[model samples]
Target: MASVAFEEIVETFDFLEDWEDRYRHVIEMGRAMEPLADAFKVPATKVDGCASQVWLMAEIDGTGPEAVYHFKGDSDAMIVRGLIAVLKALYDGRTVAEVLDTDAGAQMARLGLDEHLSSQRSNGLRAMVERVRSQAAGAAEGV
Candidate 1:
């Protein structure tokens, strides 16, 4: 199940039938995010496969499978930053097990992202999801 924060976004999306309105809402969400610090934007946090420069930094608390997952991300492109915001809603503050178990594609599909996003954006989104999952899995492994 998605977090209450994410459910709120889903409800907002449902109310905003126009994709353009939804798109603007996404950008606004991105704009609202606390900016990722310049110090954390190094090579290790940088994500591959995105057309734009993207970075994700994870902070895992606790240990093993029960570890809690949290992250901050940034992107050069406004839309991609928005995508990162969407991802944050989807994955942040969950246990590593929950993060690992989330069917991201299915969840994103609920927002009609699969239909509205460009192919490149879709691939970028997948890459971002992979990065989050990898971090969660690593936490689960006590890495």
Candidate 2:
């Protein structure tokens, strides 16, 4: 899977004339996520701050110090699903150190995500970032 750039996301939205098309794009991205296995799905990993039910699982491999984030979510909100797709592309397959150092908030702002999103949606996005950051921090501490 290719990691989508902020510019690419903008171009994608621009290509679509209406919100319906944009929404379809978002849904398609969500559908692209790799499914979480039943054994990996745990309540403790669920992101509670989101209005929608969002589950995130992280696998850290010491071989190359790579971290993989697997996400599964269901929401009535289309934009939120798109936002999650963006995050999954960016953060998955990265190292804990890399994820901790990345300026995810700034990138999101540059994508105009906050401007286009409702307050609730924006909060949910931030919550996702916070959860990832927390996990990265724990891993860095060797917890």
Best model number under lDDT:
1
lDDT of each model, Cα atoms only? Answer: 0.94, 0.67
lDDT of 2 at 89: 66
Kindly list the per-residue Cα lDDT of model 1 for residues 31-95, writing each as its tens digit.
Answer: 98888999999999999999999999999999999999999999989888998999999889999
Model 1 clash pairs are none
Q: What is the Cα-based TM-score of model 2?
A: 0.74
- List candidate 2 stretches off by more than 4 Å: 1-21, 38-41, 63-79
Per-residue lDDT of 72-126 in model 2, one digit per residue for the tens?
Answer: 5444455566677788766766777777777987777655566667787777888
Worst 10 residues of 1 by lDDT: 1-10
In candidate 1, residue 96 scores what lDDT?
Answer: 96
Task: Give candidate 2's root-mean-square deviation (CA, Å).
Answer: 3.6
